[model samples]
Target: MTGAPITADRLASLTTYREVVQQPAVWREAAETLAARSDEVAAFLEPLFALPDLRIVLTGAGTSAFAGEVLAPALARTLRRRVDAVATTDIVSNPREMFAEDVPTLLVSFARSGDSPESVAATQLAASCLTSVHQLVITCNPEGQLAREHSGSNSSLVLLMPSATNDRGFAMTSSFTSMLLSAWLALAPDQDPRLAERLAAAAEQVLGRPDELARLTGRPYDRIVYLGSGSLGGLARESALKLLELTAGKVISYYDTPLGFRHGPKAVLKDGTLAVVYLSNDAYTRRYDHDIVEELRAAIGSENVLAVSAQSDDAESWQIDGVSDVDDAVLTLPFVVIAQLLALRFSIALGRTPDNPFPDGEVNRVVQGVTIHPLQP
Candidate 1:
């Protein structure tokens, strides 16, 4: 059965679809929220940057973790500091390995709910382990424990995104993108004046052509591979999770960088696997992406490979026109929408509810059944 365009009425009936469609508007709101508070954010971060031994750790779980992964490379380049993307789950499990006592660390926590046990525990662990640690909580939920606990701290700053970004769906659609944009705008130097407008326009272009991309999800592919480079590689990881989460694990997925895929991960490719490659704008990186697409097309045929690019001469590529001038870092905003739409369509195609793909209580919006262990002093 071929997928169809999700209409207004249909979108209204599903929380996931509604959140997905409402993303562009929320992104603008998030940008405005950050812009109005840029000076305050700068004030909070500037002093930490002045510290000679400062290290920035971007930490979160699941989609939130991927947000840090997407921003870490670009932020490290902009700040000229050692920036690391670490998952809260990992931090909670191995606090000693992830945190050091000598380095003055900035723990930038990204969380949709901010209430996750790992999120709270990781923040506590950082404070306990590092002698000089500052916390920056970027979360959608203002009332979450992470926000309320650190709101008045001298060493912590909690930046709450627009309230609409507190996603109501099982999967994070608006929440993920809004927080990603908020962090990018908050941290990047010489912020683009036209970023909000360009992001909205680019998102609208993708939103208008859902059917074109939805049809691609209708094929009989049991496995999907998402590939990209640098910041886009983090996006590929998020994209893979979206499909896996929205489909309730019915469709197996894998994500890797274009170069990394050739290093044994490409073995996952099979007869029923569909490969989605996000081509980079960097001249050097684009060559690797293009070569992978060519090689995949030859191996699995064009029907199984989908190439998403801002500028590509390939006839089979999904060219996102008019945004070629945007930097690949910022372009991640619209590029992610393609993955969101595919997950929604694939969920429907598999006879699963996108809003709650796993109604049996196997997985949840906020993770369950996790025990936080006391760190040994």
Candidate 2:
């Protein structure tokens, strides 16, 4: 079964496939839950947000870290405060650097199991180092260490994702989007009023057309580069990771901002490599993205480059439908679906099981083998 064509029956049996397909519905449910609990969430956050010099840090590991990166820019703009997306791995490795300032800080942790050693240690380090620190844990597992420890703390708030999002599969699909949507709703409730509907519509369109998407994945390219700008740059990073993980490193994948690629990264482009540029809705940023799309097309041939856009003005592009003119953060929802499907298809193409690409336990689902050394003051 390994490295063979994945038949329909086999595909149906894979948890990754079901998780990927269930995302749109999961997003809608998550949005509705967040909306219903808006007042309570607001009540808990209002005072903390009211602090004039509040500092917000979004922390998580792996895919969870990318969520913070994707949400930070837009949240900072909306809240008019300093917002940072730092990985828990970084926080544990260098607590003094991460928590040097004793300012009032809000550590928003995005976790799937809420049990990653770094996840727990980062929160602990924040409380230890900061004089006035609050925690907002957006996690899938309610029983995990993070949720259990922070459950009743006046300074901590735990928002559990939809139960199904805990993700039985090794790779995180629904959990990432679920936590991202939930965090956006909690942090910036006023923006993107129709985010859930628009995201669900666009994602449904992508999910309904697997055959067409499979065609794109069927290409012989062995290397992939995903490019974006601003919030979409974080999206691009996650997209590249999905491909690399789902293929179990069989494919070499890279990610960079549309403009950043020009500096030295462009040297990586050559035969057997494909570039997927995520075109931004912001006209200003889109220009740079468009420039790269054109450059990659000229360099690698149009057949080897793909433009993921909402406008879809070009020939070789995947247009996310019904979510046009939205913020790049909202667009990431549908954009990620395209990447998830691509990764799944690529996994099948290489005869790797999408559910468990690392059957030998080389890379566990929740991540393992990290010793959390006590951070000395």
Candidate 3:
């Protein structure tokens, strides 16, 4: 369990995770498809994106919400457009607060199953209340209600992600990352051609060196902190969730930005703790990020610190090479690839199934026992 176990069953489980590790390829496929549909998305989205009074809203729940978290900041920076990632849970309860009739709005919804109550409800409510609104639906379950409900509305676009991303276990391991990558491809087409290749290589690199991450996870850590900045923050949050969910609350996990963590959250770095820092590739950002990490190294004596970055901060840095020219936004894959591997190794350390890390059913693959409610009048 300390290394990449190559048993048939474990290897099978690793298959989905390995495929997910190839997220750069997945992103490439999504980008290529989106490119092919550029005319369609453009002809359809140009005016909507160009609206003088337009707001682009990204909505989802759980890890799906994290997808938007990763894309929103990067999109705003690159596209220079007003974009936001809001949870469907928030939108369903407070439509007026999230929507406005004064502006043309486009709601980009990410759903793993597309059947989540809030997913459909939020979509319906937005259409019902907003004067000019469009829907961009991304989901794994093409047969789910969200995909089926699209009525050829000129404003609606439903894109299906890869099949391996449609996870069947109680946790969204691959599916979550896949959907998130899909959005990145859809939103940023001009990044770099080598981005996907670098990510694919990173996947193989991490999987090949699984023992390294597995050994780190095998440590006795009661508290874990994931520190990141920019789009990588979303990946940090997801990584923290994976450890928490897979371990069934045995290991407490929290996610925060590098600078933000020093404020008060850093108090969690007690003995038997793990700190995972995701440093940015942007020259200035990484400098600040590494500075914060250096601070942690000096003060957090008892906690084990693991730093992942596209460039080397010091000898301790886990260099995610081959992503030199790739935008840090797209280069996020290497850090995420490493984080996912860490989570899996941690699951093994805790003697749990990486496939279904949650044994008591507190967390689930598609989520469960929730009624998909209708929009309240």
Q: Highest TM-score, which number?
A: 2
Worst ten in a row by lDDT for model 3: 1-10
Best by lDDT: 2
Selected candidate, larger lDDT, 1 vs 3: 1
TM-score of 1: 0.96
Per-residue lDDT of model 3, residues 53-152, tens digit only: 6788999988888878888888887778788889998888888888755478889999889988789888998988888888999898888889889747
Between 1 and 2, whose TM-score is larger? 2
* Model 3 misplacement above 4 A: 1-25, 301-303, 371-377
Candidate 1 stretches with Cα past 4 Å from truth are 1-8
Assess candidate 3 and give its TM-score to the true structure.
0.90
Q: TM-score for all predictions?
A: 0.96, 0.97, 0.90
Q: Rank the candidates by TM-score, best first.
A: 2, 1, 3
Q: Which regions of candidate 2 deviate over 4 angstroms?
A: 1-7
RMSD in order of candidates: 1.7, 1.6, 2.7
2 against 3, candidate with superior TM-score: 2
